[model samples]
Target: MKSGTRHPTGYWAEEFMRPHQAFLAEGYQVDIATPQGRQPVVDELSLSLGYNDNDQKSVDDQRAYIAGVAALKAPLVLGKVNAADYDAVFVVGGHGPMQDLAVDPDIGNLANAILSNPKKVFSAVCHGPASLLSIFDKDGNWLFKGRKLTGFSNAEETQATFAGERVAEPDATGVPDRI
Candidate 1:
């Protein structure tokens, strides 16, 4: 999953992309989706690249997904997506999630549809987990209520960016109170 040109970096992006490879290798078909369903961008600032660039494991497993996405040249843009068709959904994270995923009505709708489907598995990582802002029911409660979950920790955000990523106040983005 991607949002705002879902860039393919940061701890979260790397985590989702690698498992994506394994899922593909095991014969599971995966589709990347994003708000606006546009191409996703990688935040070049994630420091993992500097030390790990040439390391074979890091190169093939992680960068391969980035290159793989690049080869496809476009994502399925989530805004136009139909979630009923997939058995699982993952939203990859970057600085972009706070910028885009949190407020898209479609993302909230997609998350609701996916989580409501009993067999479907939904997951996100790093700031990607911020996509949860959209996962609500008609009553405006999170669908994952009482379910164990994880998300971007304040400490992680502090470590990932040079300056604390200054998210505009929530009202500015129109995302819900929790994002």
Candidate 2:
């Protein structure tokens, strides 16, 4: 809901830009939510236009995304929005998400809701999928325990950044943490 910061670990910048633009153009109302409801800092490393340079289509898409983000309605306070309003949920990735999304009960709950429906698309990239680890079935078992997913791998995060390692990416597959 706020600006993201430059992270100790690296984030795949193009991945973040891609879906943000997709959702915006699909006519799906977009919202940025985070724990604590303050403006989260963007990871400067993830925002480098040079490093994550988009292709021509991607560039045009991002122009739309920038406009959409600039014009978004007031940030939805994560704790207040209900899940039913959304048709699908796409978690945007960044090292910043590793710092909070994993433990956010609301985000976890949202994942669970979206996962409950096979028709719904519950997706993410980079470290954003870490939030999936927080979700559980009715029995409290890990909901994404076996779901195919992607995340910022620890090796990817460590090798690409000043930060040697991070807890956000699980040691196993790009699946969620509870696995």
Clashes of 2: 12
TM-score of each: 0.71, 0.69
The list of candidate 1 runs beyond 4 A from truth reads 1-13, 51-65, 70-72, 142-149, 161-179
Runs in model 2 deviating more than 4 A are: 1-14, 53-68, 71-73, 146-149, 162-179
**Candidate 2 lDDT, tens digit per residue, 52-90?**
564556555544554455423345677776677777777
**Candidate 1's residue-wise lDDT over 1-179, tens digit each?**
21224334433446556677788899988777666656666555543556467465774565566766652356677778788788888776676765587667788888888878788987776677767766678977666555655666656555644323354233433333543
- Over all chains combined, what TM-score does candidate 2 have? 0.69
- What global local distance difference test value does model 1 have? 0.64
Task: Give lDDT per model, in order.
Answer: 0.64, 0.62
Local lDDT at 68 for model 2: 56
